[model samples]
Target: MNWRRLWAVMLKEVRQLRRDRITLAMIIGIPVLQLVLFGYAINLNLRGLDAAIADQAGSAGSRALVMDMLATDVIVPVREARTPQELMALLKRGEISVGIAIPADFERRRIDGRAVAQVLVDGTDTVVQSAALQLAQVPLDTTPSANAGPLRDAGLSAAQRISVVSFYNPERRSAVNIVPGLIGIILTMTMVMFTSVAIVRERERGNMELLIATPLSRSELMVGKVLPYALIGLVQTTLVLLLGIWLFQVPIRGSLLDVYLASILLIVANLTMGLLISTKARSQFQSMQMTFFVFLPSILLSGFMFPFAGMPKIVQWLAELLPLTHFLRLIRGVMLRGAGLFELWPEVLALVVFTVAMMALAILRFRKRLD
Candidate 1:
C-alpha cells in the first residue's frame, strides 16, 4: 500500500474524468438542463378546475347562488346547461371536475319558503373534489337561513359570516406548492446520477491506472473532480429558479441567496455519496443498479408526494436520514414560507456533514482498493 501510488492514481483519474465529454455532460450539463425542465414548470395542485352548472329553476335567486360558487377561487364555470343530463356527460368525458344543479321548482319553492340546491362532485380526484366541496358549502356556513330556501333571502344577510381561508397551499394554486418540491427531487436525482457516471466511467476504460501514476494527492484529486460537477449543479439550480419565476409565476419569498447556497450544499452531498457508490461498483451497470436502489428509497421515503406525517412512524423516521427530506424542508420553507438563513441553518449544517462523511469514505475506499 504505497502512498505515492495512490496519489498518482487519484490525479490521473481526476484528469481523465475532467477530459471525457460524456463525464463532463453527466457532471455539468445534465443536472442543470433537467432542473430547468422538471423542477420549475411542473405542477401537482388542482386549480381553477372545470365545473358545469345546470339551472332548472332559472330563478334570479338560483342564479345568484351559482355565481357565488363561481366567485370562489376553487371552481371555473365552463358552461351553463338547462338539464342535469347534459352536465353528467361532461363529467364522464372528463371535461369538468364538478357540476352544480338547481331544482326546477327552485324559484317557486324558494318564494314559498322552501329551497334546496345540489352540488355533484367527481369523487375520483380527492384533491379537486375536496376543494369543490369546501368552496360550495362556504356560503351555507354563512347564512343557514339563506340556504334554507330561496324565498327566505329577504331576511338574512350573508355579509356577517366569518371568512374562510386556505392553509399550506393557499390560492388553490398547484404550481406554487409543487415547484419547491420538484426542485428538491430534481437536484438530488440529477446530481447523484451524474457523479455516479463519472466514477464508473473510469473503472470501465482502465484509465484509472493513468490517473494513479500522477503526483496529485488523493484529497486534492477528489476536490478537483467534485468542483466541476458542483459548478454544473449550480447552473441547473439557476435555470430551474429562473423558469419557475417566469413560466409558473412561483414566488421566491425567501432570500434567493439562501436557496442557492443551501441547494449547492445539498448537491455536493449527493455527488459525494454517488462517488462513494462508484468506488465499490465493478462496472457501470452495477453503478446504475445501485443508483436505482438509492433513488427509489430517497424519493418514496423523502415525502415528495406523500405527506411525512401520514406515513407510519418508522417510515417517517427512516426518511429523516435521506438528504431529500431536509432539502425539501429548506426549499419549501424558502419558496412558500419566505424562510431566511436563521430558519434554514440546521438543514445546511446537516448537508455539510453528510458531504464530508461521504467524500472521506470514498477517498478511503479508493486508497485501499488501489493498494
Candidate 2:
C-alpha cells in the first residue's frame, strides 16, 4: 500500500546484493559452465557404439556387410567371434552392445535367393539398444527386395519397420533433456539457498529490528527482499540457455515468450520458499542444510536422471508434489517438444499454484512472527 516505503526497502536490498560479488558470480558463472560441459558431454544419439561380430560363414558378402555397418558411424566393431556362444558370452560380460551373426550358408542362401542374417543386440540400456537396432537393419549387398513379392517387396518387412521413438527425449540424448531440467534445478537451488542467506545475514547483523521499525508491511518487505534475487535467477537462466544454444546447439523449439513466462513464475516461487526457510532458520548453516535436503528430492524425484515410470509407486507419488518435477516437464516440453500453452497447461497450472502457495506461506509466516 505504501509505495515510497516499498521502493526504499527494494533499493536497500538491491544495494546489499550489489555488495555481495561472490554470490553474484556463483549465480551467473556456474550455470554457463554447466551448460557448456553438459552440452558437449551429453549425446542422445549414440555414435561409434562398441560392438562385436560372429561371422560363421566367413564369406565375402558377410564381410562386406560388416564393413558397411562400420562405415555408418553407429557401430564400431570391437571384436570378432567364430561362434554364437562366444558372442553371447561377450555381450553378457558387457563388452559389446551389438553382435552380428552371419549364417554359415549366407552366401549359398544369397545365391539361392534365401539369404538371412541374425542381429543380436543388448537391450538393457534404451539409448544403446535404439542405436544397435538401427545398425543391425543396414542392408547388405545380397538383398534384391525390389523384385521380391508382396510382403517383402517394400524392402523392409513389418517387423523391420517397427518405429521406436524415445519420448521426452525423442533423440534419446541425455543432454537435451538434462540441460533444461538443470536450469530449473540451478534456479531453485541457487535462489533458495542464497535468498535464505539474505535474511539470515540481516538477523545475524541485528538489522531485522532496525528494518522492521520502517513503514514497510510484511508483504512489501518480503517482495523488496526477494526482487533482487529474482533478477539474479533470471540472469542465470539467460546465461545457461545462451551457452546451451551457442556451444551445444540445443534448439529452442517453443516460443521464447512461453519459456520466459514459466521461468518467472518458477523463480519467484523458489525465492519465496527460500524466504520462508530463512524465517524458520536460526543460522546460515542451518538454512543451507535444509536447502540441501529439499534440493536432493527435487533433483531425484523430478525425473531428472531416471524415468518417472520406472520408479516405484511411492516415489512417483512423491514426485508429483515437487515444483521442480513440473518445471522440468514444462521446460523439456517447451524446449524439445515445441509444446505450446495448450499442450503444457497442466504443468503451467502446477507452477502457478506452487508459486502462489509458497509465496503466501512465506508472507503469513513473516506476518505471524511480526505480531
Please report the candidate that would top TM-score against the real structure: 2
Question: Listing every candidate in turn, what is its Cα RMSD in Å to the true structure after a full C-alpha superposition?
Answer: 15.6, 15.2
Compare the candidates by lDDT and give the number of the best one: 2
In candidate 1, what are the lDDT values of residues 260-348, reduced to their tens digit?
A: 87788788889898888878676676677667667866776665765443344455677777888788777776665566656566777
Which regions of candidate 1 fall more than 4 Å away from where they truly are?
Answer: 1-164, 368-371
What is the total number of backbone clashes in candidate 1? Answer: 9
Q: Candidate 2's residue-wise lDDT over 1-371, tens digit each?
A: 99999999999988876776544555675576456424543345666766787888886667887787788787778887888787766554445656777778766555444434666665434455566667546764544445533333335432343222233344455567567877898998998898777677787888888887888888888889889888899899999899888877777878888777778877987888888888776678767766865786677667676544344456567778788888876776677656665566777788788878877887787642332
Model 1: lDDT equals: 0.67
Worst 10 residues of 1 by lDDT: 157-166
